[model samples]
Target: MLLLSACGGSSGNAGGSGGSSDDVLSLALENTLPGWDWRKQISAGHVGLEWRPVYDTLLRTRTDGTVVPNAAEKYSYNEDKTVLTLKMRAGMKFTDGAPVDARAAKFSLEGFRDGGGADSLRLAGVKVHVVDDLTLTLTLPAPNPALISYLGGSCGQLVSPASLDSPTLATKPIGSGPYVLNTRATVTGSKFVFNRNPDYWNPDDFPYDKVEFLVMADETAQLNALSTGQIDGAEISLGSIERAKSTGLRVDSFPNVWSGLFFLDRAGTKIPALGDVRVRKAINMVFDRSAIAEGIWNGNGVANSQTYGPISPAFQKDLVDHYPYDIKAAQRLMKEAGYADGFSITLPEVDHYNDEYSAIAVQQLAKLNIRAEVVSVPRQESISRILGGEFPMFVYKMPVNPEAEQVSNVLGPKGAFNPYHSEDPELNKLLAKWTVADGDQAAKVYQEINRFLVEKAWFAPFGNPDLPWAFNGSTTISGTLGTTPPLYAFK
Candidate 1:
């Protein structure tokens, strides 16, 4: 299974709306909403799909990833790009009658920054200030072009200042978006119902009068729902592509995520063999990415050696398959690293990932005399076990976001994925250059970093898997880079 990180929630019946198909836009999500708390919600995967309709972001991104104004009509940056100013649309009010002003914007931004959301780190060291009723400013510690992109996502979602401190905020949302959550009709973990906001400033933008999301974890059930007209759209796996196409549903396929092994023990504190660059390169050469992409992803993806995806500015065409499958070459490297007799390593078996990939990887490593052990852990405990340094390596899937966001989340010294906090002076220097550079200079620096990561064998990337979304004839959805498009994109 191609697993995206999601929070587990209770399961319940998917109650029907009993309304005409034209009036109600129904969709199936692979998981339920973690909660209504904007501060706790993840900005990617299915979670964003759930709550975005009820919240208006300060900025929105086009399908091509360009930042455009949404709730905030205008925005600007300082000369050094360290200060961002936002001008909110006048007379906007939340569902509960609270004005969506600069104070509310500052409150929401500060709440998210301090609330420990999955993407909260994006707002770290940033300060929000209210310039006036219609304007606000964000002061950054350093120049970060990616901050605008983050605003286009959950980090930019605004909440009512009146409800921000309410205990019921976790279950009820108060925002100025085009939709209002129908809590009476919603069943926790099963179905979510939304009613059209009569007072919304941009009513024509959202065509549906009523929106419903059914949580269907199983792909087969999702396919059944789509075919039977129970839902208008859903995200399906690669294996279900043919079945979905046969049913006349439009299958939108695009490369959005990358899956493979994350080598977290580059410093070799826990796993000595993994510390050596030669052994890491040897491990990268052992896997035939072409076969894995075809076999595991059903030929829906292309073999990739670098972490950067095609949509990213840092993506280099020549770096797609930097390492070819060559057992002899891998053996030579192992010998050079003084690991001719492979060592033992333990990998975490999280519920989110399909064990088949790990099994195949273990079998392949056995050829080099490496003894690998898999320890099964619950999904809730997986992050703590993996990031807490309990496991040196693990197979996982991650989003291919913009170059700067990717660097901060995965490659930077204090990145969330960098558990051991491994620091490379050369990599740090490149990061500083990329942060201050812009236009062609920024792209060049990012590409250089991508090449450096591949040459160093920072990760054993399998490939970029194609994400397929099936929509009925009545619904039209556009694809976005790195993530599923926001709920408003559905028409």
Candidate 2:
């Protein structure tokens, strides 16, 4: 995802409403808003486009990878960076007339940390304190470089304290955002309507008078809606790419997700052969990454040496060539590790695409004397199996965060997705240093962690998925997807 500017993409020259009239954009969301409280969720399924109109966050992250105060006007931190302070603008009132003060913000943030489902991880060790009407402080157990980024992400969106008191808050929320959910035009579970907030703080920034969110999980249905002018924007499936273009709808494409093979036996506790670094390196060297990327995904994605996005600064082009496919080298490594006859390994796959990945892997590993057998497991049991060390290797999709903290968590021993149960003490110490480091120090630590993971063959990286977001030609979008956690602006 792009660490985008507040102004997303350049505006289209296509003559349309130019955001006059109601400027009510009917956007299709992948899932229904299970609840209205931002604490429960701030997005449909973490894309966060649908959550913008109803709430705002403390900070807004920019394309230049810097953060500017949004609802917050000023901020400070202690010498050690464990305690952070933020000053909110005075007189910022919610649509329901409650003051958007430090106390209220504290309550809102606490609600999120206590019950934010998946997002609870973002504020794990942080404690919130109301200093005064304008001042709020966040105390962290450890230094966090991405705290500001997290506050500007989906987890950062805040709701009004008054909204939480409402019995119908799960369906209707009162917020300080630029729009109010209009029940008159809304249909439960199918469609939602948001009328403009008359007393919104930054009225000039919000061009639209109304915005509508619809649960449109079907790509074909979203396409039909776009043609009929029923919706203005929707997330499109890969199969709908051509149809969306044929309809003249503008498509915004970004790095979707990283799908690759993960090594779970770095310690070789379950798989003794994998304890040898040569054996692990051999596994990474066996696959022709270029062929796997180009042949399997076609133009949908580009071959990536590491799991990080291509645009990320952490990506080291210099080291990408280290693991180029060489059958002779792979065989040598295996034989050096006393596996000249190859070894039998079981790989678990949940999805149909991964099943195909298994097939290709089996064909390649056979040549190197490694017999790879794939076992199909139900998708629901995949995570448990991974955590339980049921498989030595598995095909998986890793979400992109574009932040050091995310990678830190994933590569660390305490990470929720650390399926490998990786417990390298040096790695842990490096991560601890990375966690506290700032700017140049942080960058240096991150690069080391990123490089270490790749060099150790922790993951056999593949390519980025090309996720295309379809929008009607009538709307001129100025903001990019996956930018600010709240909402993209209308150009």
The candidate scoring highest on lDDT is 1
Q: Give the alpha carbon lDDT tens digit for every residue of 111-168 in model 2.
A: 8888735456668778999888999999988877767766765556767777767998
lDDT of 1 at 327: 91
- Tens-digit lDDT track of model 1 for 242-300: 88999888898868678888899899998899989899888888888999888878889
* Cα-based lDDT for every prediction: 0.79, 0.69
Once fitted onto the true fold, the runs of candidate 1 whose alpha carbons sit more than 4 angstroms away are 1-20, 341-356, 374-391
TM-score (C-alpha) between model 2 and the true structure: 0.79
Deviation of model 1 at 422, angstroms:
3.3
